[model samples]
Target: LLLFVYESDASPIDTFDLGPPNTDVTVHSAISTAELPNTTNTDLAHVMKLEQQPLTTCWPGRVLYLMASNFSDKQKWVACLEAAVKSIQRKDTIVRTGMFSKTLLELEGSRRLELNCSFALCKELVLLGADEGLFCVNLYHGTHAIITQLTGFKCVHQIVYISSLNLIILITGRERSVVTIDKRMIHSRIDQANSAAKEETNPIPHTVIEGIVGCTVMDASKCHGGSYMVVGMADRVLLMKYNSEMKSFCLRKILLTRGITL
Candidate 1:
């Protein structure tokens, strides 16, 4: 390892090679060096008396004595070096513990191959949307089932689930329109798929929320006695309200944004 010191502006001033011939032992406090009978470094002893603890990189072949400007600085250096050493000692264990992966499914051989998919999660249920359709996977029981096949969608770009209203909104990339589905429909399909113990199935019904087209991004929230949706378009933003009686979102207000949004 190479340790470097930098100026306040981050310009490298000095570097020490703490590898190979210079690094095989533990670092020790400067006060421990004062107790050594053969200690000849009066500077280190003096620094210890001034409340600045020093450290020695006591390499097997050579020793590099280092001192900090203050007690806090010394503690920081000691803590960092000790942490680095601990990290090196558990390098393999750390790699093994930190890395993980799981294969969900193979789509290459299936005709229902998803293209440009979007994903959303609600508790143990995972929602996946593609050009072909929307799918729900129950992680608890390993049930993968289709919620609905979105009609005329070239690709599903974004999927948002509003738990407050138990509704899901999907944005189509090519059509530039919004599709809404009930969360109850997803759960019902998962239940049916789990009982049948199958992978593929017919889709549930869905409603395409019309009028609002050229949608860039959309989000919904329920607050202050009502549920609202904020939909972004090429030149404007639509603030729509959810009408529970109609089971659809209705346009409420519009705000013009001359430029595109994030």
Candidate 2:
């Protein structure tokens, strides 16, 4: 095997092939250069061209009993199975096409301890609730904006989108009390960012329900086409529903989990 390595520092070549007896000919440094592709670009190009190799390509008759005697053989079969499952799973995932293809946008700002995400009144908009504040992203235009008035919070526990009421209900707080902001006012501010947005805005009106306040909310979800929502706490599950005017969320019931002592 022959290996070719390009040297970066090129010294002047001193060769004695003159017409006279012993004349030395000196070559300039610009005569030779080390020209190679960037290491990162080469790696990314290699990764893009790579494809998964199936285990059955070598072993012909392992369809019935997929058994392996060694660890390396087991890993090959696992890789093949994972690749096959991913191919089948992508077909079941939902996709929403825009006016054009998916655009890649580079994010500018930063956030600490990202917690939850919820869809806005328009399906294309996404609300990202982090520990610092709430950030908005327009999926259609691929733009990001921060809701200035929605700051000064401990931690964002969960975010749920109530599409029927055009509201984004999110829970935030670490201990003592969990604040729930269920209102359409925040949605209008996000919508206004696209049409007519301004600075120095007032605080959005919201209510705080105490059913799952002290308990740590593990997860929050809203039923499809239903007026009810469920919040999974550390020990119990909280069930809530919107009022007739769709203004505030009232606790309907709580499903407590039985605890056992060791």
Best by lDDT: 1
| Model 2: colliding residue pairs | none
Candidate 1 colliding pairs? none
The sequence of per-residue lDDT tens digits that candidate 1 reaches over residues 1-262 is 3335643445444444333321343455566654545655654543231121112343234344566776677777777766765565465454334433355543444535565555546566666677665555555553243333323334777888888888778886576789877878767766766678666444766788878778888888887989988999888999999898998899999899998755
Task: Name the regions of candidate 2 deviating beyond 4 angstroms.
Answer: 1-115, 118-124, 140-154, 176-183, 191-201, 214-226, 258-262
Q: Which ranges in model 1 have alpha carbons more than 4 Å from their true place? A: 1-92, 95-124, 140-154, 194-199
Taking all chains together, each candidate's TM-score versus the true structure is: 0.58, 0.46
On a 0 to 100 scale, what is the lDDT of residue 72 in model 2? 62
Q: Which ten residues in a row have the lowest lDDT in candidate 1?
A: 46-55
RMSD of each: 13.6, 20.7
Candidate 2 lDDT over 1-262, as tens digits, reads: 1112335435533322211111111212111112223334323222211122222234222111123445465556556545654554355333312313454334544523354544453566566666655655656664443333353444565676655665566667665244545556666655565455553234556666665555544334456655676666666777777676745667888778654111
Error of 2 at 196 (Å): 7.5
Scored by Cα lDDT, where does model 1 land? Answer: 0.63
